[model samples]
Target chain A: MTTASQLTPRRQATRARLLTAAAEVFAERGFHGASVEDICEPAGFTRGAFYSNFASKDELVIELYAEHAASLRQAIAEVAAQPGLTLPDLLERVVDIWTRDPDERRRWYLLTTEFALHAVRDDDARRAWQRLQSQIRKELGALIESIAARHDLELAVPTSDLVRLLTIVLQGGLGQHLLEPRAVRAGALEREFLPLLVEATTR
Target chain B: MTTASQLTPRRQATRARLLTAAAEVFAERGFHGASVEDICEPAGFTRGAFYSNFASKDELVIELYAEHAASLRQAIAEVAAQPGLTLPDLLERVVDIWTRDPDERRRWYLLTTEFALHAVRDDDARRAWQRLQSQIRKELGALIESIAARHDLELAVPTSDLVRLLTIVLQGGLGQHLLEPRAVRAGALEREFLPLLVEATTR
Candidate 1:
C-alpha cells in the first residue's frame, strides 16, 4: 500500500521501469503468456527488484492502470485550465491527447481486456479489479461533470452514464480496429462520434 | 462448407448437438480451456465424431458464430415482419429478443471475446474471424437500412457507422455488466440508450 512517492528515489526509479516493461510485455503476450522473467529482463531489473516493488504481475498491472488514470486526468486538467478555451476545442484536445499514443492505447486496451476476462472468472481478481475500477470510474465521472460545468453545458444524461458511454465507445472502437487494422482507424469511433454526441446531448 | 440442410436428418441432429455442447463448454472454460473431449462428452459423441464434423476447435467456433448470427438475424426479421409495429415497439422487441436468453448472451459474448483476442494476436485467426465478421456486418447493415427505410427514417450517419455504434455499445455495456452486475444491467445500454441514440441520430 506504500505510494510510489514514499519510496526512496532509487526505488521509485526501479518501480517505474518495471511498470514500463510490464505494459509492453503484457500488451504483446497477454496476461498469461508473459512470464515474470520475460518482464524483468526488459526492465533491466532482477527478480528481487521486481518483488521489492510489487507482490506479483497482477499487482503491477493495478498500479499501471492507476498511473494511467492519474496521468490522463492531469492531461485533461491542463487542457481545461487554458483560458477562454471553447467547449469544442476542449473536446478536440481531449480526444487528441487520448489518441496521441496509439501504441500505448493499444497496450492499455489489450491488457485491460485480458484483466477484465480474468475478473469475470475469478472472484479474487474480480474484487481487485472492481475496487480499482469503481474508484477510477467515480473520479472520472466527477472530472467529466466539472468539465461540463466549466463550459456551461448541460448533458442529456447523467455524467456517470456519459462516462459509461465513452468507455463503451473506446472498448468497441479499439476492438474493431484490432480485428481489422486496415479497415478501421485506431480511435476513430470515439474521436469522430464523441464530439457529435456531446454537441447533440449538451446545451 | 456443408449446409445443415444438405446433411441427412441424423447428421443434422448430431451437428446441432455438437454446436450446443461447444457453446456451453467454451463459454464456461474459454476457447483454449475447453478440449475436444470435453465438448464430445456433452454431445454424446466420441472424439472421432468431432474430427469428422469439424477440422478443429477453431473451425467449430467459426461455425458457432455463423449460426448465432443467422439465428439472431432470423429473429430480428420475424419481429420486423410483424404488421402495425411502431418504431418504438420495433426497437423494444429487437432489444427483447437480443437480451432474451441472458445465459446464451453471456456465452456468446465471453466466447467471442476470447476468440477476438486470438484474432488480434494471430494472422490466420484474424483472417478467419474477419471474413466471417465482414460478411455478417454487411448483412446486418443492409438489414438495418431496410428496417429504417420501412419506417421512413433517415439516419444522421451511414448505416454502417450506426451498426458499428450499436456494436460498441453492446460490448462496452456487456463488459461493464460482466465486471459489475450489481451496478449495470445486461443489454441495458443498448436497450435504453440505443433508442435515444437512434432517435437523435435519425430523422
Candidate 2:
C-alpha cells in the first residue's frame, strides 16, 4: 500500500475534484440517475482515475456523507470554543452555516432524501448511514452538554433527546422549505423554534 | 362522459382497487420504478382498467395525495366535533391518527419524499403539490383558531407560523426516525414535543 506522503499532490487534487463532481452529479441526477462517467466527465478525469480514488459510486456517497458530518462537527466545535457565546447566538451561527444558499440547500436536501430512501432499501447502506447518524448525534449531545455546563443551566430533557429533537426540526424544516420556499423560509427553525427549545430546556 | 349513476358498482370498485393498488405499488417501487401494468397485476385488473381510471402514473400520484389530505381533514373534523377535548388532548388525538401504524407510516413517508424529489425536478408537479399543501395549511390554521377560541387561550405566534412549526417538527421528526429508528422512537414527537408546544401557546 502507498503511504500518504508517497501520494503526489496531483493525485490528491484529482481525488478532491472527483468528489466535488460526484456531489454535483448525484444532487442533480440522483444516485441512480447519475453514472460514474457523468462524474468523471465534469471533473476532467477519466474512469481509471475515479476507480483509483473510489471503489464505486456507493463508496463516493458514503465519503460525501462522512465529509459533511466532519465539517458539521468542526463548525460546532469552533462555535463552542468561542468565549461567552450565548445559546441563541450560537444557534444563529449554526443555522447560518447550514442554510446559506437556497439552491445549494435544495440540492443537499434532495441528495439526503435520496440517500435516506436508499438506506431503507439496502441493509449495508442503512448500516453505514446509521453509523454516520450516530456519530453526528454523539457530537451534538456533547456540544449541548458543554453549553449547558457553561451557562449553569440544567436541561429539562436528556441531552440525547434534545439533540434528536433538533435533528428532526432541522431535517423536517429543510424538507418543508424545499417544498414551499415562501411559506417555510430558510432559518425558520433557528429563528422561530430553536429559541423556544433552548428556553424550555433551561432551568 | 358517463354519468356517475350510470357507472356500475363493479366499475366503481375497480376504480377504487386501482387507486389503492397504485398507492401500494408506488410506495414499494417508487414513481419511476412502478408502471400501470404492475399496478393492474396486483389489483387483478388490466392496463385498460388502470388507464380508464388514471391518465398516467403522475395522475395517480396526485390523486393519492388528494385522498390522503381529505382523510386527514375528515379526521381533524371528527376530533374537533368532540364535546370536551382540550387543546393538548386534541393534539394527542391528531398525532395518534397520523402515527398509528408503523408500516403505513413508512409507506406514507416514502411516498411523500419521493413526490418531493419529483417536485424539485418537475414544475407542474410542484404546482400541484403546493396546491395540496396550501389547502392543508389553511385547514390546520382554522383548527388551531377554533381550539384557541374554545380554550380561551391566546396564541403566542401567528396561526400560520404555529402550523408551519408543527409541520417542520413532524416532517423533520419523521425523516430522523426513518434514519435511526432506535434513537428516535415512534410517537416521540407527540409524546415529548407536542405537549411542550401546547403549553407554550396556552395561557
Candidate 3:
C-alpha cells in the first residue's frame, strides 16, 4: 500500500532527470529527431522507467508545456507587481526575464517553433497548447489593464491587440535567438520597444 | 537554335503551369511533402521534364523565394513613391501589401516557416535564403529612408531596427495566420504599429 507521503525522493530525482534530458534532447534533435531511447540514455534511465514516469513522449511534452506556461506567468507577475513601476518599466522587466534566462529561452524556442507546430496539427496537443496560451493571454490581459490604470492612459487600440503584439515580439525574439544568438542583447529589446509601447498605450 | 527569345508559346505555357503547380504543392504539402512526383503530377509533367526545368527542389524553392522577395520590393517601392501621402497612409499601404495578397501570403508564410528551417539546417539553402533576405532588407531600408525624408523625421534608432521589426512582425503575423487564418486584420496592423513608428522616428 504505497501512500502519498511515501513517494520516494529517488522518484522525484528521476523525474527531474527525465525533464532535463527531455529539454536537452528536444532542443538538440527536435521532437521528431530525438527518440525515447535518446532521452532516456541521457537521463540514465531504461525504457521501462521512462514509460512508468511518462506515458509517452507526447505526455511528457504536454507536462513540460504546462510547466513552462506556469513559470512564464510567474515571471510576468513578478515584473507586473513591482511597486511604483511605470508601464515601460514593467515591459522592460518582462523583456529582461525572457532574454536573461538562457535555459528558459532554449526550451521556449524549441517548444514554440518546432513542437508547437506538431501540436497544432494534432488534436490533443493543440487543445493543450490552446489551454496554456489562454492562461497566458488572461494573465497578460490583466497586466495590461493594471498598467493602463496605473498610468492613467487609454490605449489607442484594444488591450488584446497590445498583448498579442508583446507575445509575437517575445516569440519572434526567441526564434531569432535560435538563428543569430549574438544579436539578443539583454537590454536591447526594451530600449528599442518601450517608447513605442508607451505611445501605443498613452494614445 | 535555343535563342533567349526563341521559346515558343507552348513552352512558355508549360513553364507557367509547372511554376503554378509547384507553388500550390509547396504551400499545401510543405517542401518535404511536395515531392517532384507530386508537383509534376499536378502539372502533367514527367520527372525528366521537372529535372529539365528545375535542377532540384532546392532550386525551385529558391526561385519561389526570389519571386516573393521581388514582389515585396515592388510593393514597398510603390508605397514609398506615392506623393502627398501622410505617414499613416503610407503604413496602410504597407499593411495592405503584406496581408491582402492571399496567394503571396500563403506562399510567404509556408516558405518562411518550414522552408526557412530547411534552409537553416543546410549550408546551401542557408546561403540562398540569406541572399533573398539581404535583397529584401536593402529594398526595405531604402523605402524607409525615403519615407523618413519625405516626413522630415529623424529617427532615434537605426532604420535597420525598423526593418528588422517589420520583418519579424510580417513573419510573426503570418505564423499567427497558420493557427488562426483571420488573426491578421489588413489595416489594423498599420493602425496599431504606426504610432510606434512615429514615436520611434519623431522624437
Candidate 4:
C-alpha cells in the first residue's frame, strides 16, 4: 500500500476531484441510487481511481463530512480573526457562507439528511458521525465562550447548551427554508432567530 | 365512483389503516425505496384496495400530511381547553404529544424530511405542503395571541414572528435530537429550549 507521504500532489488532486464529484452525485441521486460509475463519469475518473482513494461509498461519505467540517472551522476562524467583530457580525458572516450557494446548500442538506438516517441504523457510522459532531460542538462552545468574554456578556445557559441550540436552529431552519423558501426565506435564522437567541442568552 | 358520504365505516377504517402503514413503511424505506406492495403487505390490504384509497404514493403523502395536521390541531384544541393552564404548561403539553412516542416520532421525522426534499423538486407538491404549513402557522399564531391575552404577557416580537421562530426552533431542535439522541435527548425542545424561547418572547 502506498503511504500518504508517497502520494504525489497530482494524485491528491485526483482524489479530491473524485470526492467532490461523489458529494454532488450522492446529493442529486441519493446514496443508494447513485452508482460508482455515475460519480466517476461526472468527475472524469475511472472506477479504479475511486477504489484507489476510498474503500466504498460509505467511506467517501465520512470523508465528505470531515471535509465540510474542516472548511466550516476554517471559515469560523477567519471570521473570528477579524478585528472588532461582534457576536452578531460573526453569526451573519457564517450565515452568509452557509447560505451563499443555494444549490450547493440544498445538495449538502440532502446528503446530510440521507447520511443521518443511514447513521442512525448503522452503529459504526453513528459513532463516527457523533465524533465529528462532538468535535464541532467543542469548537463552537469555545467560540461562544470567547465571544461572551470579549463582549462581557453574561450567558444565561452553559456554553455547551448554547452551541447545541445554535446547531438545532441552523439545521431546523435550513430544513424549513429548503422546504418553504418563500416563507422561511434565506438567512431567516441569522437575520431573525439568531439575534433573538443571542439576546436571550446574554444579559 | 364512490361519494365520500357513501363510503361505509369499514371502508374508512381500511383507508386509515393503509395510510398509517404507508407512513411507517415510507419512514423505514423512504418514498423512492418503498413500493405499493410493501405498504400493502404490512397493512394486510391488496393493491386494489390501496389504489382505491389513494391515486399514487404522492397523493397518499399529501393525505398523510393532512391527517397529521388535523390530529395536531385536535391536540392543540384539547390542550387549550384545559382549565387555568398557563402558556408554558400548554407549550409543554403540546411538546409532550409531539415527543411522546420516540419510534413514531422518528418515523414522522424521516417521512417529513423525505417529503420536504421531494417537495423542493416538485411544484405541485410544494404548493400543497406550503398550504398546510401556512395553516399550521396561522393556527399557532392564534394560539399564541390567546395565551398572551390571557396571561397579559407582553411579547417582545410580533405574534407572527414569534410563531415563525417557534416553528424554526421546533424543526431545528427535532433535527438535532434525531441525529444526536444521546447528547440532545428526547424532548430537549420542550424541557430546555422551549422554556428559554417562551421566557425570551414574554415579559
Question: Pairs clashing in candidate 2?
Answer: A172-B172
Q: Can you tell me which runs of candidate 3 are displaced by over 4 Å? A: A1-21, A34-62, A79-92, A119-127, A147-156, A181-190, B1-21, B35-56, B119-124, B181-191
lDDT of 1 by residue, A65-116 (tens): 8899889988988898899999878877887887899888877877888888
lDDT tens per residue, model 1, B15-90: 8899989988897789989999999987789999999888888888999999989899889988998889988898
Candidate DockQ values, in order, are 0.63, 0.55, 0.33, 0.54
As a whole number from 0 to 100, the lDDT of residue A164 in candidate 3 is 69
Expressed as tens digits, the lDDT of each residue in A150-194 for candidate 2 is 878898888877887787677777777777777677877556777
TM-score for the A chain of candidate 1 = 0.87
TM-scores of all predicted structures: 0.90, 0.85, 0.76, 0.87
lDDT of 4 at A14: 80
* All-Cα superposition RMSD per candidate: 2.5, 3.8, 5.3, 3.3
Question: Sorted by DockQ, highest first, which candidate order results?
Answer: 1, 2, 4, 3
Which digits, one per residue and each the tens of the lDDT, describe model 4 over residues B1-203?
A: 23335679998888778888888888778787899999999778899999988877877887787667668767877887788998778878878887878887777777777788778778887887787777777877887777777778888877777876776677667767877788888887556778778877788
Q: Which stretches of candidate 4 lie over 4 Å from their true place?
A: A1-11, A44-48, B1-11, B41-48, B158-160
**Residue B170 in candidate 3, Cα distance off native in Å:** 2.5
Reference-based lDDT, each prediction: 0.83, 0.77, 0.69, 0.78
> Would you list the clashing residue pairs of candidate 3?
none
lDDT of 3 by residue, A48-76 (tens): 99988787787787667666767877777
Give the C-alpha miss distance for residue B191 in model 4, angstroms. 1.4
Backbone clash numbers for all candidates listed: 0, 1, 0, 1
Mark the regions of model 1 whose C-alpha exceeds 4 Å error after superposition: A41-52, B6-10, B41-48
iRMSD values, candidates in order: 1.5, 2.0, 2.9, 2.0
Error of 4 at A114 (Å): 1.6
DockQ of 4: 0.54
